[model samples]
Target chain A: MYRYDEFDHAFVQTRVAQFREQVEARLAGQLTEEEFRPLRLMNGLYLQLHAYMLRIAIPYGTLSARQMRQLAFITDRFDRGSAHFTTRQNLQLNWPKLIETPDILAALAEVEMHGIQTSGNCIRNVTSDQYAGVAADEIEDPRPTGELIRQWSTDHPEFSFLPRKFKIAVTGAAMDRAAVAAHDIGIRVVRNDAGEVGYRIYVGGGLGRTPMLARLVREFLPKDDLIAYLEAIMRVYNLFGRRDNKYKARVKILMHEAGTETVKRMVEEEFARLPRAAINVDPAELARIEAYFAPPAYEALGDEPALLAAARQADAGFDAFARANVVAHKQPGYAIVNISLKPIGGAPGDATSAQMRAVADLSERYGFGEIRVTHAQNLVLPDVRQRDLPALYRELLAAGLGDANAGLITDIIACPGMDYCSLATARSIPIAKAIAQRFANPARQQLIGELGIKISGCINACGHHHLGGIGILGLEKGGEESYQITLGGDPGNDAAIGKLLGPGLAGDDVPDAIERIVDLYLAGREAGETFVAAYRRLGHDHFKGALNADRH
Target chain B: MPIVTERGFGPDGWATVADETAVADGGDVIVSWKRFVAEAATLTGRAGRIGVAVGPDFDVDLHVAGLDGVALVAIAFAKFADGRGFSIARRLRDRGFAGTIRAVGPLIAEQAPMAFACGIDEIAIPDDLAARQPESRWLRAVELRAAVSYQRGYRTGASVFDQRSTGGAA
Candidate 1:
């Protein structure tokens, strides 16, 4: 985990002061609600249906145990004893009063955190692979790159008020766990044939009312020219992206309207004109940022300790947990433990204050004093030694964090829909809950094998419904809540948006429809094929009848 | 309307002329982009300095060659949330426009630091907005923002990276 330097501390503290004044001005009626909306949104404060939601950025999904404890404290003190982790790997408190938001920000600043750029039409919190440095397939750690972008985009003078909100995701691993294809800008840290590290840049990808996969604008951008190239892309978008229609204001629309070739030429021209030497980061600064992400000290130990194997054999629950939640690590003796937040029949990503504190303690006790928030709305302990898995599992079970469903159907991603969001036209959490209950049996889930069901209450696609293996979108049709199903979407290397299946089904019939689809997949899939892989081979035609079955 | 520069409020130095209005011979005057383009050669040696007021959609690259003797480029923000003016100002500076760049519209006080940092010399706000948010708020915004910035190569003070390289406090 990266520690905040003196400069970082001062920067966050000053931002707190700045937002404090803005809040005071709003309360005093010196600024109207319309004028204060963007300011508060820049600080990650949103006025939801019931209250103000304060979203705190967990930069690159990395958090120290101390920071987790502070988040727990904030949850207990200001919010209603819980918080929802978002699809972007950030945390949101749904009940913070507007007057108390400045205090919340000040508390976050104490822990090397702030809500800056988490929302509003600016470059948002830069996300990366949650298993950044610890993954086995990584070429280089992407956190340093993520951090550099974070610093560069924070209160950026030239791009603070973009035409629309911008998101950037980076991945250093071949697996692409960050969903880089769904971001406004995606950077893949790759090594060229000559073994020099560089970036493969993708632009114009986003998911809202319109879903788009990014196009490869730069086949290979030199490692040193990262900031300058990004500046060029942003400048072109800021100047040319449509502002007349808010729905079509993303960089993707710009790329679509202007043609990628013209956009690429414009970016190249701007890059050529920019003072590269002045804007490009110094090599020393890059080295300094990289130093923070160097791998932690490890002890020489063998893989799959005897005790863990014996514990797995003795306890069926432990065996199931090890099979689902434990992931391979680069270091032989270590494993990545994904603590599932999606318990059956529970909200997808809500964690109680106690659960947060428990995870915080477990991080310090079992591994390094660090934790990670996954884009799938889960928590990760990235450095847990294989020897400590048994004890960690037992403690996690006691805290009710021992759900053995990492990529299973029960591990659904859902947005805070009509239940909490003013933008939602239908309820999403209940749909997620109902689907999870339908597949609650562990044996059944294991048989299904790695299916992602994402639900969104509206077209905003906050839950990333478009990227799920089985996407369920809630819409209001004929004055009734209806759910639409889509299949074959992926968030990985072969990223593709899911195609709509058929007519919408009533909310009560959603779970049964999903079960029919799963049944069809089970009947059609070949040996050892995942849902997405099977969908690709079987094609959309094979599953077209799942929702339209005469089950009356 | 009041013009806010880095130094608090400044006096307006030029008169803005509509597109159909005829230019007078004596004092400094600002004209629309159409008027400037149609009469670029005549405006170059006029008795007064000439400035151009461009809309948000104004393409700087298409008109850069004709702005030789222009004393100022005033970028308009039709709405405060519409941020095309900031990039346009940067484009002008990047294209080697060695003249004053001003933003004119219903901009709030908090956007002053960003406007200044993006190469805009000053901002001209509507009288209503100026009345609500006085010059003191704008000055305070600029002062607070001057304390620290992480971005490099802007018109602001030393960036955090620059300070780090020189071993100075950020």
Candidate 2:
């Protein structure tokens, strides 16, 4: 994990002081609520339905034990005793009072964290693979790139007030855990034929009322030209992106309106005009950031220790957990343990203060003192030893963190919808809960196998419903909550937006409709085929009748 | 309207003429983009220095060639949230405009640093906004944000990239 240097510390503190003054001005009536809204939003403060929601950026989803503890302390002190981990790998405190937000920010800054650029129409928190350096298929660690972007985009003079919010995600691994396709800018770290590391840049991808997958603007961008090229793209968007309609203000709409080739030409022209030598960071600076993400010290050991196998054989629960929650690591004798926050019938990503503290302690005791928040609304211990699986599993069980459903149907991604969000037109948490309860049986979930059911309460798509294997979007139709289903959306290399299935159904009819679709998939799938793969093979026509079961 | 520059509040040096207003002689005057383009032949040899007030949608590339003797370029922000003016300033500087760049709008004091960094030499704010947020607030904002910035190529004493490359404070 990256530690805050003196400069980083001072930067965050200064921002905190700046925000403190802004809050005072707002309270003193020197600044109107309309004027203060953007300032507060830039600091990641939002006025939700019930209270102020302060979102804290967990840069690249990596957190040290100390930082996790600080988050727990903040949750206990200012907010209710829990926090929700967003799909962007950030955390949201839903109950923080507006007056106490500055204090909360100061506390976060103490742990090398702040809420800057987590919201508002600026370059948001740069996200990358949760398993950046540890993943087996990585070409290069992307945290350094993400960090460089973080520094460059922080209070960026030229891009602070963009036409609309901009999101940039980077993925170093071939697997694309960060869902780079559904971002405003997506960078995939790749190596050229000559073995020189570069980037495959994608632009214009976003999901909101209008969902768009990014187009490849640059096939190969040298690593050194990263910042300069990004500046060119942002400059082009800031100048030309539409501002008349807020819905059509994203960079995607610009790329869609102005053809990709035209946007590319504009970006290349801008890139040519920019002073690249001065804009790009020095190689030594990149190397300095990269050093922080080097592989941790590991003992000399072979793969899959004997004890792990024996423990799995002895307990069915342990066997299920190892099969679902654990993933292979690049280093030997290590496994990436995903602690699912999507417990059956519970809110998708809410973690109690006790759960947070326990996970922090487990990170210190079992692995290195580091934790990762996954984009799927889960927590990851990226360096857990295979030998410690049993003990770690038992401790996780005691803390209610031992859910053996990582990519299963029960592990759903949902937004804090009508329960707290002012923008929500329908409730999402209840839908997610109902679906999870429907598939609560472990054997049934294993049979369903690797199906993602994402639910969003509104068209804002905060839960990333468009990327789910079974995408469920909630809307208000005819004065009743309606759920619409989309199938075959994948967030990986073969990224595609899901196709909408028939007409929308009532809220109570959603789970049964999902079950019908799953039944069709099970009956149609070939041997060892995942839901998305089967959907591709069987096509949308095969599952079109599933939603119409009740219509007849 | 009050103008805010690097040296706090400054006196307005030019008169802004509407598109329909007559261009008087013997004083610096700013005019709309429409007037600049329509009367470029006559305004070039006029007695007064000419400045152009452009909207957020103004394309500097299309008009940069005609701005040879222009003394100032005033970019307007129809709304404070409309940021196209910032890009307009950057483009003017990129096109080798050696004259003063002014931003005119209802921008808050907190936006002073960004406006200055984007090559705006001064900001002419609406009277209502100037009354609410005085010059002291704007000066404090600029001073506080001038301490450190990671971006390069802009006017800043402390560039994080430069500091890292030169082995200054981390």
Candidate 3:
């Protein structure tokens, strides 16, 4: 993790003081709610359905054990006993009072954390692959770039009040773990023919009422011009983006109305005007940022550890967990373990304060003192040794984090629905819980295999329903909660938006509707075929027929 | 009527020329962009300075050439949340507009720092908001924190980034 320098510390301190003053002014009635609304939003305080929600950014999805423990403390002190991890790799404390928000922010600042730019119309929390530096297939570690962008975008004077909220994601690996294609600006670091690393820039991809894949703006942008190029894009959007309608204000709408070529031309013209020599990051500063993410010390070891093999052979539960949750690490003896927050019949990403402390303790003891929050709303212990798998599994089971459902059908991604969100039309957590319960059998989940079921409370698509292989959208129809299912969406390198399956089903019937689709996929799948692959091979028509069979 | 500048509350220097009203008596007057374009030749030949108030939809590039001798430019923020004026002000500054640039509307004191940083010389706040927030809040917006900005030139010239890129002290 990149430790805060003197500048970073001073910057956050000043921000905390500024927000405290603003809150005081609001309480004194000097600033109206209308005036203080945007002010609060920029600091990540949202007036949700019930209480104020504070969303804190874990930069590049990386968190230290100390930071994790700090979040646990915040959860125990300010919020209800638990905090919700979001799809943007952030944590949201749902029950804080408006008055206590300043104290919460102050506490976070103590641990080198702040909720800056996690919400409102600004360049939001920059996200990258959760397994960024540890992934074996990575071309380069994406954290340095993520950190650089984080610094450049924070408190940016000109680009702060954009037409709407903007999100940027980066990925260095060949497989897109960050879901780069679904972001407003997706950057992939690629090596040129001469072995020079630069970025392949994609712009305008987003999911909402309108889901569009990002188009390739610049095939290759030199690494030095990253900030300048991003400025050019933002300037074009801020100047030309439509602000008449709130729904039509995202950059995707601008790229849609004005053709991609026209948008590119405007951005290029703006880029030509910017002083690139001044705008690009210095090579020395880049190196300084990259040094923070360098690999940890590793002991030379042979292949698989004998203890891990014996443990796997002895305990079925341990073996299932090892098979489902553990992934190969860049180091030979180390492994990346994903701690599932989605237990059957529980909210997708809600973790209690005790569970958080347990995870923090485990990260400190068995792995490096680092934790990562995945965009899929799970926690990652990225440096666990293979030999410690059984003991870790026992501890995790005691903490109730031992669900062997990582990447399986039972591991669902869901957003806070009408139960908590003001904009939601229907509840999403209940449906996700019901589906997980229906598919609770491990054998059934393994047989179904690698199916991503994402649910959103509304068309806002915060749960990334547009990228799920089995997508469910909850909406209101004639004052009743209705669910709509979509098929074949994938957030990988070959990203595609899911297509609609049929009409909306009632909330009670959503689980059965999902089961029907899953059963159809299982029946038609060939050998070694994932749900997405089978969906592609058999087309949406077959799934559409299966979904509509009992409804009509 | 209090106007906010970087140096705190300052006196309003130029008078505004409303489209429907008669011309102001003696001091320099800023007119709308429409009036500026239609009466450019006559206004340019005047003895004192001429200024223009541009709406949110004003295209600075198309009319920048017409603003040759204009001493002041005012961008309108019809609503506080509608931030098109900030972009326009920055664009004018980027194009080397050296004259006074003022933000005219009901924006609150919290946005004073943002507007000033985007190259606006002063902010013309509505009476209601000005009375509500006062000048202290706006002055606090400009308090320097002393941390080097990572971004390149937008409002201020030559930040630490520019210095580092030019082989200055790292």
Give the per-residue lDDT digits (tens) of candidate 1, residues A1-552: 677788888888988898889888888777888889889999999989998899999989999999999999999999989999999989999999988999999999999999999999999999999899999999999999999999999999889889899999999998999999999999999999999999999999999889999999998999899999999999999999999899999999999989999999999999999888889988799889899888888888789768887998999888889989999999999999999999998999999999999999999888878899999999999999898898899999999999999999999999999999999989999999999999999988888989999999999999899999999899898788888899989999999999999988888999888988999999999999999999999999999888776332
Model 2 TM-score relative to the real fold:
0.99
lDDT of 3 by residue, A1-552 (tens): 798876677678788888999999999998999889888998999999988889999989999999999999999999889999999999999999988898999999999999999999999999999999999999999999999999889888778888899999999998899988898999999999989999999999999999999999998898988998998899889888988897899888999999999999999998998677757777778888899998977778655767787998899889889988998898898899999999999999999999999999999998879999999999999998888888999999999999999999988999999889998999999999999999999878877879899999999999899999999999898898888899999999989999999988888888888888988898999998999999999999888765564452
| Clash total of candidate 2 | 0
Clashing residue pairs in candidate 3, if any?
none
Stretches of model 3 off by over 4 angstroms after superposition? A305-307, A549-552, B20-26, B144-148, B157-170
Best by the DockQ measure: 1
- TM-score of the candidate numbered 1? 0.99
Query: For model 2, how does the per-residue alpha-carbon lDDT over A324-381 read when each residue is reduced to its tens digit?
Result: 9999999888999999999998999999999999999999998899999999999999
For candidate 3, lDDT tens digit of each residue in B16-121?
A: 8788876644568899988888888877777668889989888887778777899999888888877888878878887778999999999888677778777888
Which has the higher DockQ value, candidate number 1 or candidate number 3? 1
CAPRI category for model 2: medium
**DockQ measured for candidate 2:** 0.71
Residue A475 in model 2: lDDT: 90
Q: DockQ for candidate 1, please give it.
A: 0.77
